[model samples]
Target: MKNLFFSVVVMGLAACSSTPPAPDWQLEAKGSMDRAVAAYLEGNSRVEAAELARARAQLSRTGRADLLGTAELLNCATRVASLVFEPCAAFEALRPDATPAQLAYANYLRGQAQPQDIALLPAPQRALALSAGSGAADPLPRLVAAGVLLQTGQASPAVITQAIDTASAQGWRRPLLAWLGVQARRAELGGDAAEAARLRRRIAITQGSAADAPKVLP
Candidate 1:
């Protein structure tokens, strides 16, 4: 939401500036990146794919592989938030051109961030890099922290609740169901079959199905 407006404002401001205007591809890349994340979180995989391809094309116009890596990181972060622990392969492929800061951020998102990488993390993540928040932090950071903790097997109860609440409050179906699946697995592992069943039912409802949640365990 915010990035779309920020990109437009950048172009507007640049138009009046005496200096060189920002290139069209730069603004287009930002817009595509914003749309791609939004689409992915909303479960619009087709839209997500199209937007990513568009972003890559626009970004490639700059001849900056580092910027392309940044786009991949943003995409990877959303997946992590959705409980998808896949490696950020595209970003990894760009490592030869990535800046030190970008490399550190990639590790941070992967839950392998060292103490030195903490400073390079985004501001929201930095505050929660070492500890859980009140589960009431702003949306984006809170979920990123939850994802990191979950990836590290250190997710606190508050963090999990925050992730679910954040997704629910924002009406983001994909991450909402993903977090619900997490709760379901935890319930199952704790021998709470009833709770697990209940969580699965909720997930099914959100997914517009009458059946139980698809195997969310593990």
Candidate 2:
């Protein structure tokens, strides 16, 4: 759970048969995502506001354009999604791609796209989940992979449990918060309201602690 804004256009381009050159709007949008990322790194709030403005502008112009380039769009969508906490929009922006990884990530992201109670995913996404390997398999890669797993329901129970355990042991707050939310959502989907509520409470507790501390891991 480090905030990642993968370009929708990047995903689309990777998944599509023919690659498209980056459009001007997309370049601008990409710049926004970069700026936001940099700002997040520098702990500068103003830069995030600036990037959010630029991203929304790009999204407004590109949202309805038919045949928008996928990779660029996904990149843009991911940025926007993070800003607004809207993963559905991010996934919709990826509809043109058919790759298993992309599909699984899209689904996983969609599951927790919003901040509340969710349900079982469709079959295609489930199928996609079956094929997903542990993400890039490094810390950053694991997060990327974990995000995909969280999104697609491909994440092994042990992996999620281990993530929770590791976060507790290492005192990594944000990932723990995110994992807590994801687990709660999954529990709710599985018809375990009590379990989901427990996870939700953990999320609140972790978030409270995180608010007052410097993050060791996102």
Candidate 3:
């Protein structure tokens, strides 16, 4: 009887040890998105692509997709792809009924393909787009807005500076680097060699650090 009881207990322990824990889809999705953004910022296109695939996989496992969350993922993908490919189709496919923050991001993405449309957007929409990520919980929009404003010649240096400062304070390394790149371009255009050189140096340091960081996706 003692031998039989001991075997039963051992078998129960093995069963328990072999059973896998349930997955946390939400955490998986968030981590995937974070890693995607980090990879994109570091200019690691291969890693970015893999991380986005992972994000989509996580979202798929959640059973029901969150429209806004999906849109955010698409936005990041579009932004990164814009570096080497035309992303207007993906931008255009984003849902129109997003929240104010999301709408702002959509508009910024749209602006990349159609500056004229951006100019014709309603004043309120433009305002939201310009201030998309500022004072918001997410820092990506601010970076997007700043890039849009700088590229479109819609924002003054002071406004861009404020966006950069806000992103920096929020510890958004990627957006901060993007904003600095824009400033560097503007400096070069204006014949401010010293300013351009300083900005480039900062960009190099930031990119190096980001590249050295470990991959965050599972």
- Best prediction by TM-score: 1
lDDT tens string, model 2, 116-166? Answer: 211232233333334453322223223333555555556787667755665
Best by lDDT: 1
Q: Estimate each model's TM-score.
A: 0.85, 0.40, 0.55
Query: Cα lDDT of model 1 overall?
Result: 0.74
Query: What clash count goes with each model?
Result: 0, 24, 1
Error of 2 at 177 (Å): 2.6
Residue pairs clashing, model 3: 133-142
Error in Å for residue 68 of model 1: 0.9
**CA lDDT of each prediction against the hidden true structure:** 0.74, 0.47, 0.50
Query: Could you tell me how far off, in angstroms, the CA of residue 146 lies in candidate 3 after the best superposition?
Result: 1.6
Displacement of residue 200 (Cα, Å) in model 1 is 1.4
lDDT of 3 by residue, 1-218 (tens): 11211121121111222346535654555566567766665456777788777766765664442332443534353353222124445324544533443443344454553444444433433544545424442344444555555556676787578766765675555556666766788888999999988888877666575544322211
Q: Lowest summed-lDDT stretch of 10 residues in model 1?
A: 5-14
The model with the greater lDDT, 1 or 2, is 1
RMSD value for candidate 3: 14.4
